[model samples]
Target chain A: DQQVKQNSPSLSVQEGRISILNCDYTNSMFDYFLWYKKYPAEGPTFLISISSIKDKNEDGRFTVFLNKSAKHLSLHIVPSQPGDSAVYFCAALGGSQGNLIFGKGTKLSVKP
Target chain B: DAGVTQSPTHLIKTRGQQVTLRCSPKSGHDTVSWYQQALGQGPQFIFQYYEEEERQRGNFPDRFSGHQFPNYSSELNVNALLLGDSALYLCASSYRTGNYGYTFGSGTRLTVV
Candidate 1:
């Protein structure tokens, strides 16, 4: 069973627009949520993260909002740039060692 | 400094063959975790190693095994490989006490025919 899910396979947006990616989870034990950006032929790079205790966290242009009651979270990139195009994977931190459980990932393309 | 480094960027093997993938964690990181990413899908956890011991494991079968050295480097071994085992193997590193994030390597792509 998939604990985390990202239903959207791809998204297209214009540069300088806001890009929003959504994720949902089935497990309530997940206390931390993270977003990672991956480029072609490369490993995922950490983006932003939010703890279950907090509803929102922001780092520069990247913001993550977590809704514990809904078991859902989202990553928003404001004024998205062309370089922001990549596959974004939503992951949850759980298990005894806090192993990451990742979603299928959403491919975002920003056009100038 | 260098981030996580994985060796053998790509490899191809026949069914039933065995392969070994290596990883070197980022400087100052003590914990290492392995993940497998198939095409068109996200990464799935395999196992984790710390202080030369396997600390956590995922749902992977017995064919997947790993080892960690005294220097904090790691190796992932897959025996009796099947075609379904073809995928990208990634290595991530972080502090044992911190679960905030991980530094990932470029990954090694293994294709089993």
Candidate 2:
């Protein structure tokens, strides 16, 4: 069973526009969420995270919003640039366990 | 300062063989976690080691085992390799402190024939 799901396999957006990626989780026990960006042949890099206690967290051009009631979360990148093109993964942490359940990943393409 | 580092960036093994992969965590990090990523899928947690002991493990089989040295480096051993064992093995390093994000290595791609 896939606890975390990224419905969209890929997304495309124009530069300077907002790019939104969505994710959902079936495990209600998950309380912490994180987003990671990965480039070709490279390891994933942490981008942003949001705790269940808060509904939203923002950093620079990236913002993450969580809706506990819906068991859904979304990542928004404003003024998307070509450099933002990569695979984005959504991860969730449950309880005190350090393991993170990840989504299949969404390939984001920012067109110049 | 360096990020997590893994050795033998690529390897190939035939069925019924054994393979050992190594990892060196970043400076001052005390915890190490291993993950197996199949093609077109997200990474699956294998296990984690801290303070020279295993603190957590995922739902992998006994064929997968690991050890952490006193220096915080780790080694993952897979016995009786199967064709399905072929995947990219990723090593992540993080402090034991709560809520800290893990830094992952480039990964070692293992191919089994």
TM value for model 2? 0.97
Fnat measured on candidate 2: 0.40
DockQ of each: 0.76, 0.61
Q: Name the DockQ score for candidate 2.
A: 0.61
Question: Candidate 1: lDDT of B87?
Answer: 98
What CAPRI-style quality would you assign to candidate 2? medium
DockQ of candidate 1 (2 decimals): 0.76
> Which digits, one per residue and each the tens of the lDDT, describe model 1 over residues B1-113?
99999999999999999999999999999999999999988999999998899999999999999999999999999999999999999999998834665999999999999
Among all candidates shown, the one with the greatest lDDT: 1
Q: Which stretches of candidate 1 lie over 4 Å from their true place?
A: none
Q: List residue ranges in candidate 2 displaced over 4 A.
A: B97-99
Each model's Cα RMSD: 0.8, 1.1
In candidate 1, the residue pairs with backbone N, CA or C atoms under 3 Å apart (3 or more residues apart, or in different chains) clash, namely none
TM-score per candidate, chains pooled: 0.98, 0.97
